[model samples]
Target: MSTDFHGFSSGPDSAGGAPRTVVDWITVAGDQLIATIKQLVADGNVRRVILRDSSGREFLSVPLTASAVVGGITVLAAPVLAAIGVIAAMVAEVTLEVERTDVDGVNESEDGTPPPSSPDPEV
Candidate 1:
């Protein structure tokens, strides 16, 4: 399904492995949401993008990878944008989870230690 929106663009591909950092934030506008998404992807370190409502319900989760083939997380951005635009019109708050990868290729565990390495070749 395709919908027209001004300034809409695809996000970046993520690398395989555990994210180096998971950032959480509350946004009140779709534009901000789009900007944040684009910025995270543009940085070329993001591994996932998760969206949730104020009720703590996960609405969307985009697991990204650095492969040139665009699938998985890449296809969801448009729908997400459409939904966020609709939600923006109604004026609501949503939570954002941005998972970014580390440049050193170390997988960080929940305890903040490097875990086992992934076999996926770096892009």
Candidate 2:
């Protein structure tokens, strides 16, 4: 079985001078996890996929690029499935961190201004 999850966070990297957002979703089923990762790669906007255990500790990080997909999506699946299998044996929830391309902060706001910034104490 599979469950739905949505997590929002940002990274320090700039995309074309704009900031990029790392969107995360957590799931338990290894197969479903693989499928989700595959789709993310197919979409092309994904920068990378971070695999994490239930404790939120990342174990595997897959960097996706246009060249990597040149062979076909199947090539990417092998490593992700193997990693997921290893992680599933040890943890229940696995987190998939999908890094999206930089978005215009002003576009996210109703007004033509950047969003207010708050210090993330945890960072």
Candidate 3:
């Protein structure tokens, strides 16, 4: 489905949330996660925030309060982080290639030169 508020869209519903499945959890989690980060940034007492995956996998640990030795660093850093992420994703898409080459039994010229045994071989 599509999120109208932020214009974000997710992939197909595979987690079986039907009308109220994992998507709801994801949406709620996203909202809560942003709010929690903002809160931690605003509190100025928070030293850091450790985030983990749903399967208990440690994903990231960020030092927001001590990043800049000043208050409100996280608040200022959030947009920069987001922009970096977007730029990184775009670069990845531009640099990464996954096409399959047909190398089974194909033989072609390598340096714009035909084979020596060809009938029309150049002198």
On TM-score, the candidate that comes out on top is 2
lDDT of 2 at 73: 69
The order of the candidates by lDDT, greatest first, is 2, 1, 3
Off by over 4 Å in 2: 9-19, 74-80, 102-123
Candidate 2's residue-wise lDDT over 46-86, tens digit each?
67778876667888888877676664466676666787667
The lDDT for every candidate, in the order shown, is 0.49, 0.58, 0.32
Q: Which ten residues in a row have the lowest lDDT in candidate 1?
A: 1-10
Clashing pairs in 2: none
Inter-residue clash pairs, candidate 1: 14-65, 14-66
RMSD in angstroms, all models? 12.6, 8.6, 23.4
Candidate 2, residue 10: lDDT: 64
Question: Clash number for every model?
Answer: 2, 0, 1
Span of 10 residues, lowest total lDDT, candidate 2:
114-123
